[model samples]
Target: MDLPRHHTIRESSHRILDPFTDAQLATLGRALHLTPGTTLLDLACGKGELLCTWARDHGTVGTGVDLSTVFVAAARERAASLGVEVTFVQGDASGYVAESAVDIASCVGATWIGGGVVGTLDLLGRSLRPGGIALVGEPFWRTDPPEAALAIGDFVTLPALVEQTRDAGWDLVEMVLADEASWDRYVAAQWLNVRRFLDENPDDELAPALRHELSTAPLEYVTHQRPYLGWGVFALVRRP
Candidate 1:
């Protein structure tokens, strides 16, 4: 629907499509000690960067599901280009069920697919083999939230976020946090994407809205998101 369409447009120029730099993502894969033949399922796997890169770097096999048709196509193309054996599917990732239990079940940066972080962990758990890992990317508060930050919804400070993860029945094994620069890198690129689109399709119905976002988003991010919000991909394992 509109969400997928908007995402495709907003992130057209992205490869990883999250706040993570390529180095950080590679750090995660290495920290996990990824082995050849590891099987992974990624839900809401935008552009399938995580899966595709892991497949190439660690010899992992993966399936990635996303709602954006163009993203899915791009993912497939990326896999082919990398000579990695990974599958990409276009569909509603919220209800995706992997064909089989996988060594890793991940829903990074798109936990809304299962409502929120805990629910997403549960969803990923459903497709994880025993002893498998569940990877979730989520936002946490870095400092005391201002009144404006409260509107960001349900995000707690880092310690509480970790506690919440533990309460959700997983042990947080490893994490990779995004800094202010990373946030800027992820969002500033969207401004360029929107500008390019609007320049080419000035008459498009979405143009005005995008123009509004382009005008307002940078300030909003600098004022609120950059200082207060921290995002990270967390590696989880079932609690004993």
Candidate 2:
């Protein structure tokens, strides 16, 4: 299926869908020293949170593209509410290029749009101006995962992740990682969202799936992802 409706429903209540807190997002902006008039292009941008917030705080302007119509609508509403110079389009992010090259290009938390991390980097590069930054949010193996966890994901170790970026023709310049707290917040919020959704739409078609996921997700995270998986957004510069 080219489109998955379930993820949008599962994360309906989230603004920043990744494991990054608002503080961490602000920290990344500060670390980048974002100035007025900088432009961003975010592929697979969830709710356009990065674009809207950066536009508000750093005086940047940006465009975000995501596949989910609901997310794009939400992003537009957010932009209107925040009075930000940003546009969110609903379409497949893979192979989408900006009309004009942007200062920053990113595919955070959805590298699958381009198949994987390296592939996503190549896709993000297509919309980047010369010497502009590329950002990728990805998961790494914090430690060796058990066979079960390995079966669940295809993550590499952190060092290997850096090497993959290098191989993909970018230098990993900076990164902001998620600790257990941020991870918990991101994952735990889904439970509440699912609970609320189920309560409101008990007879909906997705209820069974959501109920099944809610029942098992916490245990799954604690047993597998918690100890082994780590997520972060890494900033990159094109290799000279």
Candidate 3:
């Protein structure tokens, strides 16, 4: 599916699709040393949860860019709801030129920008001020990817993922791993969203497609991802 529609679906299921939980956000905040006056940029920010939170909690100024107009509207509404001043732009994150350099930049769970992790960091680096950090949330294969599995989607092993980041001039500053419970929570949430969509749009053609996707997702995830992928978040800093 194209990115816009994919992101629309993700925005519809964000909390569930997200690998990070509330507890994990706390951990990440501590890891980033989030503070007042920090300028952050969230590339592919879905609904601007983190961006708005950072602005409110840390007094951070931020910008969030996403391709989905639906998500952009949601993000803006969230920012207003929180009474936090943050810019949420509707645009392709890969092509989004920063209005100003940021002290921290992030691409949580959307690494397609730089062709993968390494490239994403490089792109983030270019948008960062000196001594800035790049926080990337990525899924790693717990074991080596099977030939068939690798072909199924964008995936990489843990060691390989780490090696590439290190080679790309970033030092891994912090990390958080997802447990089985987290995985189940994240994936299962999708079914609820799809079900809601079906109830509201009974005659919509995409409903069946979404239903089929949700029905098969758990099995595919258990078979292909559970045994192979190790999901985690990493905060990387450009070496000063």
Error of 1 at 141 (Å): 0.8
> Candidate 2 — which residues are off by over 4 angstroms?
none
In the range 162-187, model 3's lDDT, one tens digit per residue, is 88888888898888888777777777
User: For each candidate, what is the lDDT?
Assistant: 0.90, 0.90, 0.79
C-alpha RMSD of candidate 3: 2.3
Model 1: weakest 10-residue lDDT segment is: 1-10
lDDT of 2 by residue, 55-92 (tens): 99999998899888888889999999999879888898
Q: List, residue by residue over 19-50, the lDDT tens digit for candidate 1.
A: 99999999999999999999999998988899
Root-mean-square deviation of Cα positions for candidate 1 versus the true structure, in angstroms = 1.2
Alpha-carbon shift of residue 186 in model 1 (angstroms)? 0.2
> How well does each candidate superpose onto the true structure, as a TM-score?
0.96, 0.96, 0.90
How far off is residue 119 in model 3, in Å?
1.2
Scored against the true structure, residue 222 in model 3 reaches a CA lDDT of 78
